[model samples]
Target chain A: MISVSMTVNGKAVSAKIDPRTLLVQFLRENLLLTGTHVGCDTSQCGACVVHVDGKAIKSCTTLAATCDGASVVTIEGLAHDGVLHPMQEAFRENHGLQCGFCTPGMIMSAIDIVNRKGHDLDEHTIREELEGNICRCTGYHNIVKSVAAGAHAMAGSK
Target chain B: MYAFAYQRPTTVRQVQSALGKHEDAKILAGGQTLLPTMKQRLASPSAVIDLGHVAGLSGIEKKGRNIVIGAMARHAEVATSEVVREAIPALAALAGGIGDPAVRNRGTIGGSVANNDPSADYPAALLALGATIVTNKRKIAADDFFQGMFTTALEEGEIITKVSFPVPAKAAYVKFPNPASRYAMVGVFVSKKGSDVKVAVTGASNEGVFRAAGLEAALKGKFNPKAVEGVAVDGSNFIADIHGSADYRANLVSVMTKRAVTKALGK
Candidate 1:
């Protein structure tokens, strides 16, 4: 087992984990942060999306060992007190999900898209940027709506 | 994934030492490809040496006439780098189009070239842009580096440190991606430097990424899409699969090349 230490969702964490343990496994098993889902462990589905050093990436494929000194943020890290994050609220308001299995990943990825593309996102850009996150529910029409609203909400909040 | 010892090295010298010590070691650049293979039990390396922490391995800068990218620079980084955008916008566009947003956030250009997947986009860019692969051992030109499918001139224990690409006058990459996997079904990269022109095709060849001499010769002086019109490429060497037949891919090669040259001209 390799000893690993890093900041997760504003918490400093250090644990003895198998050297081959994936970042998603560490988050779900070691820390019990299950919001980051693992729909396809092969990196095809973005159900394990999370922020490492402020950039969203697939956690299923990233080794926890390689992220020793980095700052990581997951779905659980997004909300403050009892209020949902703007993106999460936007999803709820816009009916962005049906099954809700891929919501955490979608919310995380949506935040990154907003961060990179800013609040003036178009439908086509939102559709193109969502190539990573796959939702079998809602046919992506409402998800795109949620992202656009969320981008505006995020801008308003700031 | 099988149990393995993990080694994180901070320097190129340390990478060499770790490789020398571990008999069956695999260098991990970005886990986008390697980790997935390991999860499926396809690769069972005894030791995994991560080059993430290695110094002097991740950045994009313009050096003289070439755009030099550190080996560990992520696709997202290259896609967004101002230097790459200014020096070679097509390269930035190519990097932006690889995989998805999350995969692009982690996948490195060096890893893509090292794996040399027949469907990868970088090899087409490397070959067409005339890139020089810089390793801890020595520099190998792109022409001498790619040997065959999933193969390269890299000896065991060698680590790619950087890649330097000559900034072409204009270039563009046109890729027809496999819908589900997003790996290129056929990718064409066309570039022109002065009067010299190059056309490279990836993902369609059974032999791996290769230059299309027929298309290059036609576009040498004219450097236009019309020059590539009605060009017949031999489809016998193309890999025929359910996604596309050899003839289909051969036809796509011409179409993509023509589109790329037209796009290059626009740039």
Candidate 2:
């Protein structure tokens, strides 16, 4: 077993995990942070998206040991003191999800996109950026709206 | 995923030593492709060496007339690097268009080149720009690096440290992305180095990314989109898959090649 230590959701966390353990598995199984869902075992599904050192990455494809000493932020990190994050609020307000399996990752990825690209995102850019996250339901009409709204809200705050 | 010993080395020497110590070791660059393959039981290494912590393996630098890119640099990093954007804007756009935000953040150019997937985007750029693959052992020219479909000239245990691309006078990449997976169903890279013009096609050929000699010869005479108007590429060696037929992909090579030239010319 490899001993790994990293900051998760702004808190320092450590665990003794197998070298083969994926970051998603470590988050869900070891830390019980099941908010970061795993829809597909392949990297195609962004259901396991998280922020590693402030950049969005597919946790399913990231090894837990590779993130040793880095900072990670998952879906569980989005909420604060019973208030939903702006992206989460935007998703809820815009009806971005139907089944919600891809919500956590979608929100995480959208937040990261806003953090990087800011509020000038267009519908086409949102669609292209969200290609990594697959949603079987919704056909992406409302998801795009959610991202745009989130971007607007983010921009309004700054 | 099978159990393996994992080590994160912080320096190049330590990375090389770790690689030298383990016979059944795999260098983990971005883990975008390798981890997925491991999850599917396609590749089972006894030891996985993580190169993310290696300090010098993740930057973009301009040396003389070449753009030196660290192998471990993520697609997002390359896409956003001012040096890459200024020197090779098309490369930055290509990197920015790969996969999505998550994949771009995690996938490294080194891992993509090492894996050498037939449908990847980077090989087309490297081939067209006449990039040099710098490894721990020696530097291999892009022309001689890619051997065949999903194959490269990299010897076992030889790790790629960096890639240096010559500053092209003009360049662009055009790709028809797979709808679901977002990988290139067919992609073309067109570049002009001095007076010589090079055109490379990826994701459409069974032999992987290769120079389109017909297109090259045509463009050499006239470096414009109209140069490829009547060119016909032989589909005999093109890759035929569910996304497109060999003939269709062959036809797309011309179409994408034309579009790439137009884009490179900023038309």
Instruction: Choose the strongest candidate by DockQ.
Output: 1
Q: Write the per-residue lDDT of candidate 2 for residues B92-158, one digit (tens) a residue.
A: 9999988788889989999999888888999999999999999988999999999888799998768
Candidate 1 C-alpha lDDT tens digits along B1-267: 999999998999999999999888999998898999999999999999999999999888899999999999999999999999999999999999999999998999999999999999999999999999999999999999998899999998898999999999999999999887888999999999998898999999989999999999999959889989877798898989989999999999999998999899894
Tens digits of per-residue lDDT, candidate 1, A58-135, equal: 999999999998999999999999899999999999999999989999999999999999998999999999998999
Q: What TM-score fits each model? A: 0.99, 0.97
lDDT for each of the candidates?
0.94, 0.91
The deviation in Å at residue A154 for candidate 2 is 2.3
lDDT of 1: 0.94
